[model samples]
Target: MYTREETIRRMNGLGRAGAPFFFVISHDLEHNLLFERKDGGQGRSAAFSLPLGERGGLRDCPPLPEQIRFDPVPCPLSRYAAAFSSVRAHLLRGDSYLLNLCVATPVKTNLTLPHLFRFARAPYRMLLGPDASVSGVHGRACACFSPEPFVRVRGREIATFPMKGTADAATPEARRWLEEDEKENRESATIVDLMRNDLSMVASRVRVKRYRYISPVETRGGTILQCSSEICGALPENWPSRLGEIMMALLPAGSVTGAPKEATCRAIAEAEDMERGFYTGIFGFFNGRDLDSAVAIRFMEEDGANLVYKSGGGITVMSRMEEEYREAIAKVYVPFDL
Candidate 1:
């Protein structure tokens, strides 16, 4: 684990030298891994890459395996309800306007970590740790198949795409509902405002380029419509040399953490009663001149004797416990190109 200061210095130096690198910063900003592109030794740090379309030079991944099955047992409705109540109380008390609460659901699967990654289809994917070398079916590994970009920079332009709303796409009016729902619109707008503020700290001329837009995401359970917004800003001169500092300013991804960040994060910890570890974290690559990264959502970590899928959504004063609980459970599916 590198100290935040040390991580910043090292990233700045690498950025100045124009060296290609990849980094994963945990949600709490306590643990981080940074590796040079040429480093072949996997020490707690394995393969981390942006979605194929975003990576300029990385080779495309091989085809997925024939078939795989994943079975997940979500957190009890009562438990999620309790967490939701806590967040709602906080909202009522003016402690936070919005909070992103999450839970880990224990999953049973017939495939190992590598096989799971090979079969999973996502816009952004990452595999961390030494699980691939182990012959047994059981091991400690964390895989992130995410769709939201935490931030991306090319030249002097930086952009963040914050995803906030979700609905079952199979429903007849899913896309229309997601786009027109007052609650969902409020949720996405809040995060977009937070992200715009975050960017303004290290950037100039921050603006919301796009408002709430609906996109279809494919998952094993079926298609789900997600609402997202694009916010972009102009980085100050010599921005690349301050890459670490800039990232530090926007971390834990506003989309996942919530508005009024510090207080909301505290409430999240107190209500959830578990460390998020790397889930909801940030991972991406800086290929010499450009950077592309994603929020570590749609994540699964291998715990002893079980795999845990971590997922959640935003909570507000208008949020319903049952609706939030259902959203959490619905996010547990893995995407495959069936």
Candidate 2:
């Protein structure tokens, strides 16, 4: 178990807190990786481009056999809703600043840690070398390993894209669904606005660089569409010193926590009925100069004899109980056919 102090030290040690910005690191397996921005310290760290001939280090570890499989275990949404509501009420009352709410779905899987890691995919198609690991119960399952998001920081331009909603888009109009889904659009807009406001805390000229954008991500299950918004702002020349503090102002990520950020986070915490741990925490490599990180989502963890996939969506006053409940469970999939 990682203590809060230990986690904080490691996070700060990665140089994400302060100036030489130019590296990428995953917070943990099954999490997102953070990349330094292009203008990162005058290109001291260039974007990590995969070599055309460079195949990821998947060969070092062969893929899992076809016969490998396991039964499924599920958790109830009413329990999670109750937990979310509890936290929501407290946050609404102004008891906490920001809270990261999470729920664990105990599941069974036959694949080993490495096998599961190889199954997930993203926009960057990470050059998976040996930098992967998993944690979970022995006979149950493991949290698929992953790093953080790819971030680019330059001068006063700080931008972030947080992925929020997910849906099975087997239809030819896959892009249409991502763009038109009412729930998805509503959730994305809330987060985009929240992030813009967050940047305003440390930056000027805050704006939405991009609106509801669709990124076609290839997962193990085929292709799952994810919607995101890009928000940016101009920081002061002395931003390096205050980078950590600025980020802290945007804790638990707006995407995971509904608008009226504080209130929503509390509700999520109480409704989920479980601690999020590092699930939705931001992670990545940042060396003072500029920092880039990804909101930890689409994550799984090891808990006793079961592999718990932690997932949820943003909730608003307009959110229906049944829809929100289904949304939370809908995120539990591995995004692959296996």
Candidate 3:
């Protein structure tokens, strides 16, 4: 693992840019080491792409309000099947419990691809610019974001949203509907419990301020429903110094991974066929007093000359393979709104 100092130095080397670049924090199972990389200077070469264009919706589209065009390159299913069986065996042996198994789907689209337009239109949505890229590895596309704390410094306050569940959101009340959904509830609880433990590690006191809160994001794939639980705690005066450690303690965000973190991570190593690269790492910027970062999801990496978007959902013992398969496919998008 790159030392906290090393990670910060890399960021500083990028100079002042539009935003802090993408970062990937990955632990190699075989090597048992952590890796960090700044996005390097690849942002200048990066050509953004989105599915939505001048064309309003695709012609002859479904009536579903959340429906959108999704196209991905064909990938071999045999590979994913083998990996799933391996993970299932581990679960059966009790080596690991819940794991988020994933695979990459190389994609191509005939529809309009949004690049310069995204920055021109929605500036906040643009994560990285000229210096935007993963932190540890060079010349790689990765997704990373801040944890989005709801508290500010100089006070005795803290809040974190432990995002956990996902569902289809094609309805007008997508957020409200998902808030009461059972499947989402169970998943959010597991991660909320995990986050509470995480906060307790470095917090003076912790509390579950809210439970089963919902957020909806419109993507090219459709309206993805996400459920999160808010937890708060009291931090020490020296909390800023240990912020890196606190974030590291929550490595491989529980929401993206699964419950019983360690074992589940092991299962991911055994079950996941392709290298995750920077898919689930966290990245953000801190100006000393406060820090912000994001769990690297909604990410795309290049496989040779082709771009492959990586996405998947957490799996429990209750997870169905068919449903999981659909979720994996549903994640590929160019960040287009339906």
Candidate 4:
């Protein structure tokens, strides 16, 4: 565990020395962990599928259970409505243009975090905390399987893919609908604009490479459509030296926190009961030259005897309470194969 400044200094050193390492930073930027890529994760925690490379020398991927049992009990409707109401009130009051509201729902699953990580179908995944396994059940505590890429840096170019809207794939014309919906479009466009500005702070010639692109995400429960856009910028020649500083400039991710990042985050604290912890935080792997990372959505954590899945969606002035609540609940499912 390292303080923010200490973490930055260490990352600066690693990047400057062209050392490959994995890192996890908490949502509030309070706790940071860095693992050298040499020796296949000497640190207590293990991470793999880091977008840029794989974490080697891990236990073999286990086969899925014959009968995988997973059931998530959504947050109570009244409670979600109250939270939604609070966020809506903020939107109406014009304190912020958009605010992301989230909730923690209790989930029952036969599998543990490590096994869950193995079965996760996400592009980016991480497993951390105390040692745990099926028979041991000591509880590892934190597990993340994210489909959203926070940002990727290759050479002197930096790019970000911000996922905004989600729709039930079972719905007819969901792809077209998500692409055309006013609220969803507004949310995606706002995040895209916000990210462009974020990148512009550290890079030059920022631009939108793609807008409102749709991708399908499959989970054990069902498939859903995700809307995203790609934004790019040109990094300085010495970006490797300032890698940590660049990341520090663009964090707590705009997709999860919403526009006018600082104020919206404060409003989020007032609306959502549970602290986001590392759930929406950004994690990345710096492999000497290039960097890749993901926003910690599609995430879960262990709470005592209970397994809590934290999820949520963006809220804007056009957002409807019922739909937003439904979206949050829909996001609670595990990103596992059907």
> Top TM-score: which candidate number?
4
Candidate 2, 1-338: lDDT as tens digits: 23333433444444444533322222222232333333433322122222121122344546767775544455666676676566556655765333334567766776544455455553222222222321221222333332224234666688777666666566687688778877667667766777777778868888888787776655554666677777877877765555445555556566656566655554564456565645665444454555545555666655655566776665544456566666566566554544
Tens-digit per-residue lDDT, 1-338, candidate 4: 76688888888889999999888878888677777877543554465577687763247756677888778898889999988888888888888787889999989887777776777888898877554421112233778889999999998999999999899999998988997888888888789999999999999999999998989988777789998899999999998888788888898799999988988888899988987877898888989989999998888788887778889999998888888888898888777665
In terms of lDDT, the poorest run of 10 residues in model 3 is: 48-57
lDDT at 298 for candidate 2? 63
After superposing candidate 3 on the true structure, give the runs of residues whose Cα lies further than 4 Å from its correct spot: 1-24, 27-70, 74-77, 109-139, 143-156, 171-183
True lDDT of residue 144, candidate 2: 32
lDDT of 1 by residue, 132-212 (tens): 441112335788788888898988999999999999988998888887888888888889889999999999999999998
- Candidate 2 local distance difference test against the native: 0.53
TM-score of each: 0.92, 0.69, 0.71, 0.94
Candidate 3 lDDT by residue in tens digits, 55-90 = 111233233323333468645566666776777787
List the candidate 1 regions with Cα displacement exceeding 4 Å: 51-67, 131-140
Better of 1 and 4 by lDDT: 4
Most accurate candidate by lDDT:
4
Worst 10 residues of 2 by lDDT: 45-54
Best-to-worst lDDT order: 4, 1, 3, 2
Candidate closer to the true structure by TM-score (higher is better), 1 or 2: 1
